[model samples]
Structure formats: C-alpha cells, structure tokens
Target: MKYLIVHDAAPGQFIHIYKHLRSEGHEVVVASRRGTTHRLPVKQLVYELPEELKGSRSGYTAKVIGLGLSLYEELKPLAFDGWAPDVILSHASRGASYFLRDLFPRARIVSLFEWYYGAPNPDTGMDEGAFRQQAANAAATNMPISRDFDCMDAGYTPTLFQRDAFPKSWHRNLEVIHDGIDTDFYTPANKRAIEVNGKRFRKGDEIVTYAARGMEHTRGFVEFMAAISEVQKRRPDLQVLIAAADRLCYDPGEKGKGLKSFVDETIDYDRERTHFLGLVPEAKFVSVLQVSSLHVYLTKPFVLSWSLLNAMSVGIPVLGSASAPVQEVISNGDNGLLVSMDDGQALADAMDHLLADQVEAGRLGRAGRETVIERYGLAQCLQRQLDLMRG
Candidate 1:
C-alpha cells in the first residue's frame, strides 16, 4: 500500500514506523519541513510566511493561519504527481493537511492528534490575566481542524488523558495508543558509573537526576531548584545531575530570566555537588540514569514526556508529579512515587526517602520497568499503529 505521512516537523515515532513499514515492503512517503534527516523516502518542503506576518510576537491564531497557507502552497504540487497514496497520516491541528482530502479523496486519512488546548485546564488555572485570556482564546484555532474532522477516518493519541482534551464529538474517532519505549535498549545496568568534572560516580553514590528538553514553569523548573536546595541541607553527600538547557523553551511570561536566574537567587549549594550537564548524548544520558539513586520528573497536566518512561525503563526509582499524564503511568508507592508539583519539601522528602532505602528503591524500580515492558513496549505500539493504518 502507498502511505503518505504529513507533518510540520518529522515526528520521531512515525519515522521509526516508516522504516518498519519499508522493511515489510510497503511504499511510505513523508512530506515535512526541510533539513530533517529521516533516512527514508521524504519530500522536504519549507514554508516561509510573508515578511509582514513574520514575527515572534504575532498572535497564535494568525501564525497558524499563515503556516497553513504557506504549507498548502508548497505542497499543492504533490496533487499533480501521478503518485497516489492509499492512506494519509497527518500530524495536524492547524489545518496543515486539510487540503489533502481534496487531492486524495479515496484515501483513508488519520490525524495523529497530540494536543487540544482549552482554558482553565491543568496548564493554566482561572488566573485572570492577558496571557491566561490568550491561552483560553487559543482553543478557537482548533475550529478549522474540527471542521475538517469528518474528512479524517480516525484520530490517534498516545494517552487517554491527551485524547480527552479534544471535543466530546471527536472522542469516538480518537484511539489511545502510546508511542512505546524500547525496554531492551533502555534496560538497567548491573553496575554503571559516570564521571562529572573528574569526580566519578559509583554504583552506591547518592546521585539524583532531573531532565527535560528545557527548564521552564511548565516543567516545574523553579520548584525543582528549591527542592534540590532542601535536599542538600539533609543529605550533603547527595549530588544532582541536571540535563536541560539554561534558557526557557516554553515562554513563562518572563523574557530575560530562566533557570539560571532562579539558581542565582535561590539555590545555595556547593558547586562540586551540583552539575548542570546541558543536553548530553543519549548514551551518556542513559549512563546518568544508571547511576541515579532517584529521578524527579514534573510537569503540568499536559503531554506525557518520553523521558519519564525511559528513566523508568532504566530501572531507577522516579518521583513524578501527581498529574494527569504522570498518574496514568505511575502508581504511588507501587511502581513510582507521586508528589505534588508545587510542594518542594514533599519532593525533597521523597528524594531522601528513596535515597535512604536502596532495597525499596530497587523494588520500585524493577516494578516500574516491568510496567513499561507490559504496557508501553515498542512492538505492541507498532502493531496497533499498523492496525490503525490498515483500517
């Protein structure tokens, strides 16, 4: 079957699936933003908005509209080609592939729906402010995509919590299938150590790890810094290994300040005990997890991060926030410990508790790994994706 995948940026999970499909002798075509190396059959397309509409300060809706228009113009040529797809998988919520229906009317179209924004949700409360108001209004951008929903055969989301974010009418069309983790590759080591600044961490060291794509309010970056300070007061022997950029990827309203600003003002700890490794390689990242006595992951009621599952798969105990996406994965005191996102003292206590008892930590970590193997294994997830596409 000829399968066409459309996305603004090449989705990582889909790229893996594309390779799997090719191995099974299926024709797969990926159209996305240029300069991404997918190692597959891809048509690179770059869409640039007019100079007048190009600015970071532009409204969210305006930007989406501009992107849709630009992408439509760039991809319109594909319709003229003799190549026709039997199925189309689009990662769009801003009408990026709404025009594909006109080109391939007979093809079964599916949307890989990641998120649908609404007001007063987990990310933002009922705080009266311009930013909050804008976030609330941002839900209107889904209208264009919603109008085109009937044209789509189905919608796929990684988690049920994420799938529920869309309109009630769309829930029936939505399927909950996670982009699973590779348990065999992310397995824990019998003995693993990593060197930071000439000091090597042994298997018995009290190493705590915190990681994210970026440090910002959404991920509870400031709260983590405060919690680490508290953890230091109790366990001076504890060493923190953080993996993230110093700047904010998600706008937290502030312009110049980031985690660095919070560290300078709040965190007071010996330089030797704290290490900020800015985005280490994947192999090195796995080494950090191997040496970790405990791992902390926090986020608002948003998307479930792959890092959390990967850390769990590494067989290290995790202390995650008791939020929607996290609660779905972690059961308190069973597989992992769940703490409040706002409670720094609680976070510190959880870290200390896990560090103090290696036996209990090991038990939880083993259970966490088992959970990933059972529920989020790559083979099971890939099979589900194949089933969805075949339908």
Candidate 2:
C-alpha cells in the first residue's frame, strides 16, 4: 500500500518507523521540515516551514494557527503530484491530518499518538503556565486528528502508555504495536576487545552510560551523573564512558540554567573517570555496548529510548529508570534492573551490584536478549504493522 508519513524527521523514533515501513514494501513518503539534506533510502517529500513557524514557539496557539494555514498551502501541490496516498500516516497531530484529509478525501488518515497534553511535563524547571498554554494549543489543534479517527480506517501507537494518555473515546481506533529493532544490526556480541576514541576498552574495565540528543531535565542526566559519582566512590577503578548526541555546554557563571556546566561544578571532574564522546556512528555505539560491563539508562516519564532496547538486544545488562515506557520493557531483576526515577543511590547500587556479580549480570543480559528475540524483534513488529494496515 502507498503510505504518506508526516513527522519532524529528527534522528530518533520516527526515523526507525519510517525505515521499517519502507522495508515492508510500502511506497513510503516522509513529509518533514528538518533533515532535508540527509539522504534517506525511501522516497521523501519535503515540506518547508517559515522560520517563525519552525521556532520553539510554533506550538503556541497564535503561532500554530498561522503555521497551519502556511503548511496547508505548501503541501497541497505535493499531495496532488504524489497521486494522493492509500493511507496518510501522521505523527504531527491535527494540522497535518486535517490538511491531508482535505487533500486526499478517499485515503485513510492514521495518526501515531506519541504524546498527549495534560500529562506532567517530565522536564523539570518548565514554567507551568507556559506548558499549560502549549497543552491547550495542542488539544485545540489535535481535535482534527481525533475527529478523523472515526472517519479514517485505522490508527496505531507504539506503546500502551501512549494509548492510555488519550481519552478512552479517542482511542477507539488505536492499536498498540511497538516500534521494534533490527535484531541483525543490534545482536548479542562477545565483549572481548573494543575501542572508542582510539582508546582500547576491555570487557570488565569500562562501564558505558548513554543518553541521546537532548541532555535536558527530562532525560535525567543530572541523576545519571549523581549515580556515577556514587558508584565511583565505591569502585574507584570504574571508567565511565558517556555517549551523547547533544552535550550541554553551559556558561560557568549561569546560576540556575540546569545545564551541563552545573553538572561539571557539582561533580568532581578532576578524577578523570568520565569521558564524553559526542555523537559516534551506529556501529561504534553497538561496539560500546558490546564491551560495556553495565549500561545505565535514566529518564523521566517520557517515551522510551531506542538505545535501551538496542542495548537489550545486544545482551547488555541495562539499569533503566522505573518510569512508564521503560518499566514496560524492563522487569526488575529479570531481563534488566529497574530503579526509581530520581533515586541516585538506588541507581548507583544497581550499577555496582550488576558489575560486581558478573555471573548474575550475564544471566540477566542473556534473558534480555531472549526477550528481544522472542517479542520485540523486527519480524514480529513488521507483521504487527501489516496487520494494522490490513485491518
């Protein structure tokens, strides 16, 4: 079937889903504002937004109303040229769904619900009033998407956490199918000898911790740092390797920015135990996981990170935050260990325990790999998506 997917096209969740749909033999077209220059394997249809609309304020009420008209005007011609679509799958909520429905009256329009308003902002320090206003705008804008649910053929979400976030009435057409991982690319490997940044790391010597692009409050970077310090105090020989995409570089004098500089000032950097390698290739990331003795993944109650799942696929013992999506995947003391969201001591203790007991860690890692193979593998996810579309 021909499918048109509208999303931000950032280097995260949506990209994997895009690639997966293409691999399943669907004629996929991505409508995105970012990564215009980045080459993708499938057919891509770009939508350019004005600078004002693409800014952080675009989610506001006035800004969305203005941008909605502009987006409709820009995408009309592309929809005609593409011969319309069999199904228009959108992650951009109401605006894109409404525009697509107007353009392709015959096509089934499905929206992927990654988030909803009214939920607590996982990011700390966000002004409540501003956040509430953003939510209000989102609710207003997303009405079109929700309204189309009955008219459209079907809708799908990656997790139950996302589905339950919406009102029960709106989720009538929603189906929960996980955005799965490619097991071949992220399979279990022997942690013998691995190198990062020209430094050789042995299996038991290095402990790799990871967080992605946004190092903001939502990702629990501060808590990860605190946990690292706690672990270091006990195990002085531990070498912490941090692999991140967007490393926060803050001004030294900023009082309460909640930036990376704040972490630098609080932690004892002189020990030289922590190394931050900014944005390595995918192969290198898999290699880091292969050689890691223990991997710490901390986050607030947001969408689960793909890295954690990738690590699990590779049979690396993961210590993740006990939040919604993460908790759904990790069963404490089973496949992987789960710790409280802001509990630094618990995170540190779990890390130390996993590291000290290699036998138990190996067992958990093996179990995690089995779970990925049995349930969350690419084949299973592909079949589920096909079923969703066919239904």
Candidate 3:
C-alpha cells in the first residue's frame, strides 16, 4: 500500500508508523515543513507570503488560507509523478492537505486533530476586550481547522474529551486513537542521584517537577507557581525544577511579554529553591522526572500534553488539573491525583500531602505507569495507526 503522511511537521508522532511502513516494504512518503529526514522520502514544503499582502493585522483568516494554498502548491509534484497514495494521514494543520484532494481523489484522508478550540475556559470570566480577542483567535486558528474537518474522510483525535470538543455533527466521523508513548524509552528508572545542568539532584531530596512546552497561562504555570509558593512555606527542604522555555504556546495575553510578565506578578515565589531549566533535552527531562518526588501538570481543557504521560511512564506520582482532558487520564487518589486549577491552596495542600505520604505516592506512581502501558503504549497505538494509514 502507498501511504502518505501530511503534517505541519513530521515524523513527529508518526515516526513509528513511518519507519514501520518502510520496513514492511510499503511505499511511504512524508510531506512536511522540515528540511530533511535523512533516508526517508519527503517533499519539504515552504511558502512565504508576499510582503505586499502583509497589510493588515486583522487579516489573519486570509493569511492562514495562503498557508494552506502554499502547502497544496508544494505537494502537487507527488501526484504529477503518478505516485498518488492510497491513504493520507494528515495531522495538526489548517487544511494543509485539503487541496491535495484534487490531485489524489482516490486517497482516503484522515486528519489527526489534537483538539477543536471551541471556546475559552468557562471559568475565566471574559471582559469585552478578552471576548473580542477570543473571537479573533478562533478566526485565525479554528476557522482553518474547521475547513480541514469539512474535507477529511475521517477525523482522528487522541482522546474522547478532545473528540467531544468538536461540533456534535462531526462526532460520527471522529475516532479516538492516541499517538502513544514509547513505554520502553520512558520506563521507571532506578532512584539515584542525577546531575542536570550542573545541579546535583540527590536521591531522597524533596523535589517537585513541572514541565511544559512553555511557561504560559494555558499550561497553568501561574497557578503552579502559586501552589509551589504555598508548598515552599510548608516544606523548607523542598526544591522545585521547571522544565520549559519562557514563552507562550497558547494564551495570547502572555505572548509579547515573557515569563516575567506572563505569570501572576503577585505570587510570592521561593526564587532560591526554584530552578528554571529552560527547555532541557529529553534525556535531561527524564533525569529531572527520575529525581522528582512529585510531578505536576495542568491544562485549561486544551490539548493533552505528553509531558504528563511521560512523567507517568517514568513511574512518578503525578498531580494533574481536574480539567476534561486530564480527568480522562488521571483517576484521583488512584492512578494519579487531581485538583481544581482555580484553587491554589487546594493544589498546594495536595502537593504537600503527596510529599508527606511516600507510600501512597509510590502506589500512585506504579498505577500511573500501568495506566500508560495498558492504554497509551506505542505497540498497540502504532498498529492502529498503521491500519488507518494503510486502509
């Protein structure tokens, strides 16, 4: 079978399937924005909008359409060479492959959606200005995603929570199949002293870890720090390690400003104990988790992050926000603990409780690892993706 993979970037989550198809003697091609994948067949796509068309900041919808059209122009050569794929697995882009349908009419296009950005978190009371910004953001991001959904033969989301976020009409076409984690790579490590970024993190050290792609409001960084502040007052020996860059992934309010401006200015942080290892390598990230007494993850009903699962896979007790996507994975007091993101004192209390109760923490850690192995393990998910891509 001829399988084509379309993504804003690849072989991201699709790496396992991409390698599998080639080893199985199937014709596979990847089209993405990356420059090269060494031996793998790929058509690198890059299109810069003309400066003359960069007139208004209000024309975000038009700008996104240009990006989609650019993707189509870059990918037509594959079809021109009489190499139309039987299936296309497109991921996380605003109709990047929607125009490809004209060339590969027979191919089944399955778009992988992380989440449909429907509305801002209900708890976050929006003023008139905030409401207008939310609407504009939707136009720039969600509008294009809606276009992709309209053209896809099927939609695949990682979790049921994410699937349910889409319009009710799309539910029939949507399927939930997580791009799973590598169990072997992310396994329970032997507890020991590990040195990272010139800091020696010793075993038995009271350390709390927080990780995300960036330090932003959406990831609950501000609230995490607030909780951390409370925990600091309780545990004098506790050390905090944050593994993310100072930037915004979501939350446009924090974009132009940085970590200094993004986080709540009033939260009293234990700056001496707090270490911000800005965007460490994956191996280092694992080291941080390995030394962690407790791992904290939070999201505002947004796309589920891999760091949370990675910490779980690493066999550490994790505390996640009680948001829809997180609640889907963590069973409070069982596999993992959960807290309302709005309640900073409650979060701090949970962290303090976990730290004090090592026996319960260990149990939760083991259960969390078991959850990952059984549900989101790579072996099963890879097979499912292979079937979909080869269909």
Report, for all candidates in order, the number of backbone clashes: 0, 0, 0
Write model 3 residue lDDT over 131-200, tens digit each, in one string: 7778667656777677778777876888999899888898888778898898898887676677655778
Give the whole-model CA lDDT for all candidates, comma-separated: 0.80, 0.70, 0.80
Please list the Cα RMSD from the true structure of every candidate, rounded to 1 decimal place. Answer: 2.9, 4.3, 2.7
Full ranking by lDDT: 3, 1, 2
Q: Worst 10-residue stretch by lDDT in candidate 3?
A: 34-43
Question: Which digits, one per residue and each the tens of the lDDT, describe model 2 over residues 117-177?
Answer: 5533649666888677655655765565565565567777787877777778867668887
Model 2: colliding residue pairs = none
For each candidate in turn, the TM-score is 0.89, 0.84, 0.90
How far is 134's C-alpha from truth in model 1 (Å)? 2.2
Stretches of model 3 off by over 4 angstroms after superposition: 34-43, 47-58, 119-130, 261-265
lDDT of 1 by residue, 1-391 (tens): 8888777666555766777877988777776654543445555556544566667677656766676677677656766766678988888566567567777888898778877766554454445676566565566667556745777887789999998888887888888999888788888987887888788997778889999878788888888888888888899799999998787755534444457666767677656788989888878988888888899999998888888999999999999999999999999999999999998889889888999988999999999999999999999998898889888
Sort every candidate by TM-score, greatest first.
Answer: 3, 1, 2
